[model samples]
Target: MIPAKADIEAAYARVKPYVHRTPVLTSSLINKHINAEVFFKCENFQKMGAFKMRGAVNAILQLSEEERKAGVVTHSSGNFAQAVALAARTLGVQAYIVMPSNAPGVKKEAVKGYGGIITESLPSLEDRERAAVEIKRETGATFLHPSNQMEVILGNATATLELLESHPDLDTVITPVGGGGLLAGTALAVHYFGNRCMTIAGEPFAADDAYRSFHAGQIETNTTAITIADGLRTQLGSVNFPIIKELVTDILRVEEAEIVDSMRYLWERLKIVIEPSSAVPFAALLRHKEQFRNKKIGILLSGGNVSLSQLPF
Candidate 1:
């Protein structure tokens, strides 16, 4: 069942002590460029340096004492891995993370630093799932689907809820679509509490399953998501797809070069470090600037977990 606005509020209260209430930042330069007043909800400054921490904490808090003792397991490429690890550690629960062998070294190190037991898998979704299952079997850990669980979705919605609460007059809110947890949650928050605000998603053209899924009225997949927005490489799961389809106004697709340009602009203009996935929404706004002129917009900056050694710019 889809979680309601009350569920998101409960989650916010549950996780409020654990997660950071990240600030909403404004960029006058960016506003000038888009001709709109834009508020950036800086989840890049969140715990574990990503918005994933909110969901991780909420899911962990939902576990029973026995389940907490048995621990939790999930497969993720980066941000969610660190989130689960950190959340579990904070709650005195064990965490097993199945990460792609090709995941960025910095992310892997962060997971390990958070006391996660790491099991490496091939960079395929199938392999990661298989490895997570094996870990659950071996350790009796409860498996958590990183983005598809109700608790996770509602937890993610709190970020948008906080944004809208602070900026009640925003005309629109945008977030990058990966597995669609954040977008689905944002849509729900806007539906329940916003002042006639619309929810939209920005996604990579190279990994555009969410965009396609929005139109197809069902989940979609990309054979290979070769985008620099690594956090957005995964396909939307069943749990998030329906919510996204029903509430999101549209999914805007941006090219890779545009992603890089937007990332650079945020770094240089706003003086804030944001990953490529975070840049997708801003890139989409830049691509369709005419549509949002003079409107107040909120953009969720999803993460800052980038590898300095391999800077895309």
Candidate 2:
């Protein structure tokens, strides 16, 4: 289930001190093209190179003293694993992270560098889940879902709260969706603030489960590999499906090439290094320029966890 307002609020408090209050940036050049005042909540500056830290810290900290002592486990392509490992380290708890065989070397090294126990699996949630289960059975560690858990969603909401609070005049908020925790949390936060901001979600055309599910009025899962946005490869979770369907005003699909181009643009023009996943939203802006014309838009740059030389563009 989507986290309640209280739960999200509690998570905000729980992770307040641990996560970075990433800055909001604006560009007149971008505004001229989109015909909107664009504010970016750059999560690239976030700890562990993404906003994942907020949720990881909140969920890990909320564990019972016994549970913390027992330790925690999770799976991720990159950012969430690093977030969990860093959070667990902060709390003096052990963490086991299952990552895919195709995960970037930088991310794998980061997970290990943070002192996480690493397990490799096929590049699918089913494989990751199976590995996580096996690890749990062997180690007796609590598992933290990358996106499905309430604590995760709640922790994700803190970014939205910060965005809205920082930009009271924002009329729309755009975020790239993967498993939908960020979008779900953004939706809940926008609703609670009673603000009229339209929440628009972006995803790569190659992997747009959240978009399909929103349009179909049901969760949809599929495996298609066609995007460079590795962080956005996952389909929506059952818990995140309904929240996104009800709350997001629009779901925009961006092409893979555009994702790469936008990543380059962010680095060259904005002087911000964003991952392909974070660049998807900017790609959406280029594809549907008219839709966002003449409005104040907020875009969440979800992460900056890419090696400088490994950029696909």
Candidate 3:
């Protein structure tokens, strides 16, 4: 098991100098509309255009010089691909990126531009992992799990640390649940801070594994996930599952239409362009406003990588 508080604190120290101190935005417009006092963690402004960079950089920096020389391997829907690619390039190591054929072209180009070697595979996380494993055997590369490793979790936790530090009075934190890295990390931070802040995980209505898993008491990863939030399509991983089971309190599901509209809300109201996956938390709030009304809620915006033309407006 990962160290609960101290290790997470050390993780902040280890990766702080390398990552951006991402800003938080509180909007009165959101508060009036949703009737909730809201704080937004703008991770869309993070390096490589998402929160994955925090994990990727911290994981890369933790490696020994020999390990760095040996290089790294992983798979992603998009953001983590760019994160690992950019981090690996910075460390003068190779990044073997396995992605689905259906991944956004913008992300594919960004990965290649960062000098990452790209491999196309089926969209399933298992298939992507299998491909990366095969490449690892062939190239002697260390497999860096996108959201399953302790280091990545610690890196993800920093966002919460920053948020709570800036907005000490936040009563709750809402974030999207993919492989559970962000949720796990955020929960750890909330717990360590000795704050009663509730950690709420959000998922697409179409792919509600995390929501189901929370109720089932154990994650059911065998089923295929179906959602337009391609970034959140992965099942919970070994490291994240236990942490989430222990830390997360609840899960919310949001519809596809709400996701798109939430993305638009960010673009119009916040003047920020965010992807569908990142919009799920806001969509959850919009869909179930009464649940969060009059409460001081913190929303973690997971990323900003959408193709403008893809918006179904």
Best by TM-score: 1
Model 1 TM-score on a 0 to 1 scale: 0.99
Q: Which tens-of-lDDT digit does each residue in 59-138 have in candidate 3?
A: 99888988888889999989999999998998798999999988999899999999999999987666898999999999
Q: How accurate is candidate 1 locally (lDDT)?
A: 0.93
10 residues in a row with least lDDT, candidate 2: 1-10
lDDT of 1 at 226: 96
lDDT scores of the candidates, listed in order: 0.93, 0.87, 0.87
lDDT score of residue 47 within candidate 2: 86
Per-candidate TM equals 0.99, 0.97, 0.97
* Model 3 alpha-carbon drift over 4 Å, by segment: none
Query: Model 1, which residues run further than 4 Å from truth?
Result: none
lDDT per residue (tens digit) for residues 136-232 in model 1: 9998999988788878988999999999989999999999999988998899999988999999999999999998888989888999999999999
User: Model 2, 1-313: lDDT tens per residue?
Assistant: 5456787778888899898999998888888877888889999999888989988998998888998987899989999999999999988999999999999899999999999999999987889999999988988899999888778888988998999888877888889999888888888888776368888888988988888888899888766855788888877887777788888899999888889888888788798888899998888987898987888888989999987678796
